[model samples]
Target: MPNNSLNYHNCKCNIDVMHLQSQDIPLVARLYKRSFQNHFLGHMGHKFLTLFISEFVNSDANSGYVAKYRNEVIGFVLATTSDNPFREFYRDNFMTLVYLTISRFFKDSFIRSHITKRLGHVHVALKALFSFSVRVRDSREKQEICLSRQPRLLALAVDRSYRGLGVANELTAEFCREMKELGFKKVGLSALPWNQRAISFYIKDGWEKEEASETSISFSRLL
Candidate 1:
């Protein structure tokens, strides 16, 4: 159980939830990497991870929030109400996208490790690439045709030390509240099927599971 008493930093205060700032990106990125180290995004280098989070912060369609305890960011969430976040991101940051693409192909050590592990099999790389492409397309189609234009939570991360402190709950509640104020009727999020803990958390937080595929489970809540 997370300690609810906010008595850190030698002061009596409550966790402060606020709009995420540019200065907080690095800390949030580091926390994200630590929290999801087994996920694909986690294997990405720090530079790429920073750029990834920057996209959300810089995008007009996206919004983010951070939870501060004693003035230090302990958790953060990023979301977008855009119908097609990936397409919008690519359109808005073409050059950065190109750079990242090229960098991944030639410079990413994680990619190299996978290639090496697969015994330099081109087919393995090709298969992974094709699978990723298909998933991306399917997600976009689902959002466009089956889902409403409500905010979709892209990423939510809390520092290990901050887990069980209600930081995640607070960040999510804030995200949904902001979405509602922005004229959205509901909000949604997706989690890996294997992430039972996260799924349970969302369910307990008032989100209902809407759909599940082999790769992910989708959840939503009416605002």
Candidate 2:
């Protein structure tokens, strides 16, 4: 039911999707927490979320778009042109993210359990960070292949109050347009199978379901 009348050529649309900026991170972070309460990143606290979102502004590998309706940030979409956005963020902000993660883990039992459950991922990330230089050439080779095939959509969310108003559609279109402008021929994303609303929206918005595994349903769209 999302409205798809984004007039990128003019100012006639109901909401405007603008390139995300530093000042937009705070609002976008709060929206992320509200929208993703069940996700591990949501449990990482507001300060952590703020720092994480700052990467979208501060890093070159990752970028995002924010939607505004009458000056309020109603939604946002995040996308990465390269494969190692998380690794890049971890490499750049290691000590800070470590401090934040440890602080949250001790203070919140939920995070402790979550972290414990994902220790294998932590090990791989740590290994990747330490071996970055040794593997950069090979990693970049694979990244080039992946980048040429499809840049991934990292996250997309809309303000619940503004659903079905074309904000998600416009934000998605902006993401695709930006990626295509970046020389990518396709854009890809995934959704939790239980998130029927999001899955339906992606399909209705023109993404083709490409794969379905236990954890997520992947979708891709050509420019």
Tens digit per residue, CA lDDT, model 2, 28-109: 9999999987778888899888878887885567888998877788899988776666776677677777888889988987
Error of 1 at 186 (Å): 0.9
Model 1, 6: alpha-carbon shift in Å? Answer: 4.5
| True-structure lDDT of candidate 1 | 0.73
Give candidate 2 misplaced runs (Cα > 4 Å).
1-12, 132-149
Output the worst ten-in-a-row residue range by lDDT, candidate 2.
1-10
Clashing residue pairs, candidate 2? none
On lDDT, the leading prediction is: 2
Error of 2 at 101 (Å): 1.5
Question: What is the per-residue lDDT of model 1 for residues 1-223, given as tens digits with 9 covering 90 to 100?
Answer: 1444443442224778888878988987888888887766676667767877776675666787888877787889988877555554444455664566557758766665654544433343344334433344665665554345767998888777767656788889898887777567888899999988788889989999999999889999999
Error of 1 at 105 (Å): 5.5
Q: Local error of candidate 2 at 117, Å?
A: 3.9
lDDT, each prediction: 0.73, 0.80
Q: Which portions of model 1 show Cα errors greater than 4 Å?
A: 1-13, 91-148
